[model samples]
Target: MQRMGGASASLVLFLLSFSAPAAPIPAGFVSWDVTFPGNSGSFDITNQTGPNASTFPDTTFPITTTLHLSGLGLTVHFANGSTVVEPSSYFTLSADGESFNGSPIAIGGTNPLPTSATLTGTFSPVFITLNNGTTQTILSSFSATISPSAGTTLADGDFAIINATTTTVTGTPEPGTWFLTVAGFGTLLGWRKKGLATFRNLLERKGAL
Candidate 1:
């Protein structure tokens, strides 16, 4: 009877700390690079923690994502020491994207991984919507451990979105933003070459490339 009780308690704990793929990002942070015709920059997504923020089951070293929402929140930074905190209606969403490459596995090919592995990507639905009505985006260092239980589809990679914030980043970006933009673009193109995919939504629109 004691063993059964302990088992029940474990299961209950799992249920209480539940987290789902693309469920909704907890109110936290997000950072992304912004690029124009030839110029590029980056900005951070900041917000207030909600009432249940403390209870949100956050996976240690988890991956982050953005949704590129259509309205009510938008911001941008540029290379010429300028920032664009457009009105809420100025935000736009684009469904054009694909998955990134899964982390490199050993060449020898173990049928199943004996231990956990860490992986991250910029194009997967790693972000979640917070109950506080604000979006939670992640920083560049987001990550996760890969185990058999995660799923095969996820074996490919993750997703990302473009977000504009209420605040503005006024500055000439450091070389980091340019480098990150290059990396982001390269990854997106590689996913295309891999025949990953791009979704289309008339509502979100796709003006920026």
Candidate 2:
């Protein structure tokens, strides 16, 4: 009976280990939450920027580059009331992290909109470093679009004067993590089956089954 109790306790501990929560975010990281028409998410960025400020050609506006980010949790809410937790993807900053310039992961799809129309693109080569020191590609590609309302204007031929009402972004996780997750579940199942069998045999021998 004592041995069976010990085995049951060990099995419970192993199951709890698999169901443990994620690690907490480190200190000194700034948290941000953004919500648009189609999706909402939260992320944490390093509080400081790079040492040197970058500037555009023929302009003197100093652009401070953000250092790094982690804990990027995103969710995509579809029109049919379905929601998907988007994988953590690498985000780039242009113009103080508020704008994008021709990159595939552009927040607004494009920097300077010559005309008001819907633009579509994808986010490629997106990856994030996990807390375990493993670099994983949480998101592979995305389909996004941006449409400007009527009477939108450009300021000094540099910035766009428009409101981003709705934007759609989507992505999928890489296969490596998925495989490991499946394998872990399989191992847990095997352990559970073996433990139950042993417990049953002991109970039968002791006339308790």
List per-candidate RMSD values in Å.
Answer: 29.3, 15.9
Candidate 1 per-residue C-alpha lDDT over 35-105 given as tens digits, one digit per residue, 9 for 90 to 100: 22123222223222322234334532122333322123333332333444445333222223221111122
Clashes of each: 16, 0
Tell me the TM-score of model 1. 0.21
Model 2 residue pairs with clashes: none
In candidate 1, position 14 carries an lDDT of 35
Q: Which sections of candidate 2 miss by over 4 Å?
A: 1-171
lDDT values for all models: 0.32, 0.33
- In angstroms, the error of model 2 at 194 is 0.8
TM-score of each: 0.21, 0.24
| Candidate 2 minimal-lDDT segment of 10 residues | 160-169
